[model samples]
Target: RASLPSGFRHLPGHFDRPAQEALVAELRQVITEAPLFTPVMPRTGKPFSVRMSNCGPLGWVSDLRGYRYQPLHPVTGRPWPAMPAVLTALWTELAPDAPPPEACLINFYTGDARMGLHQDRDEDTFDAPVVSVSLGDSALFRIGGQKRNDPTLSVRLASGDVALLGGAARLAFHGIDRLYPGTSTLLRDGGRINLTLRRVTRAA
Candidate 1:
């Protein structure tokens, strides 16, 4: 395995099986309040491969207008579900100096769903790190430098694992290339759930 880019931290099995199950239980309630909706490209209106929902004061959404943080759900027209406490705790533990996260993007991947390489530049503050948690099946996570064409390294992220992209790597181009199915039994339906905790705005 090649060395990960600077400012990248990977914590394998950060959550034990019991803890992972507890987190999933909390997510079930979140999904009920804010159902997963397909996000489309800005102008092309092409839908992303993964289904997404959010829980926080602000939620990341995509549509004809493009990616931005908003307080309401696109489909429900209601405020997004409250950010789970477990996630907040995770962020605080890993990013003690950063502001409390305002957005927790829930990405549910099934079948062949995958995310493309991209920078998480939508947030107002780059000082805060993005804490990503993986559940269910494992997946091949790729990370590159600030530029899209920068050399990349692939990591196999499994259930209960956590990755923190902070400091220099906060704007790094990264995404999931593919998933290894049947790698875990965390999700009842046999897919993957990724929780990305991000601070959308600068602290007061």
Candidate 2:
């Protein structure tokens, strides 16, 4: 946990082999209901390197219109599948004090795909923490301060590892630098899958 910064916690191997397998099975089902779609950047409409999908009441989406949360898939126009019980249980176990998450953004990275430094700020509020669980391969996860240019730290997140962004680090700048293609055997085809659970709307 050297230089991990405050409020940003990384729990490596938080899910064990069997739990990870179960979650992967559930993710396969989620993909069937809401197949992955390529997301584009705002205005420029530049396609992201990763394919994305979601579960829960709302799903995060990006395009020429920018990032936002909606109940349905941007392409299929069908409501996202309900948040699987396993994910909900994880959230409850890790952050019992916070309200339950309403959106689970599923990202699938292949080849040399990587995400740039960014903050998760589109949500209505940051009262609840952003919980991310890594599966399939490993990624070099970067984290910086509230400012975009703040000094950063890098950590290798393996499958079943859980990372948390909450409290002071709720809006911290973080992203995936790259993936170690064969680091883990969780996915049959080889790649990395990430499940990021968040509270999209403010609690009543």
TM-scores for every predicted model: 0.98, 0.97
Whole-structure CA lDDT of model 1: 0.94
- The lDDT for every candidate, in the order shown, is 0.94, 0.92
Which structure among the candidates has the greatest lDDT? 1
RMSD of each: 1.0, 1.2
Q: For model 2, how does the per-residue alpha-carbon lDDT over 117-196 read when each residue is reduced to its tens digit?
A: 99899999998999999999999999988899988889999999999888878888888999998888889999999999
Number of clashes recorded per candidate = 0, 0
What local lDDT score does residue 43 receive in model 2, on the 0 to 100 scale?
97
Enumerate residue pairs that collide in model 1: none
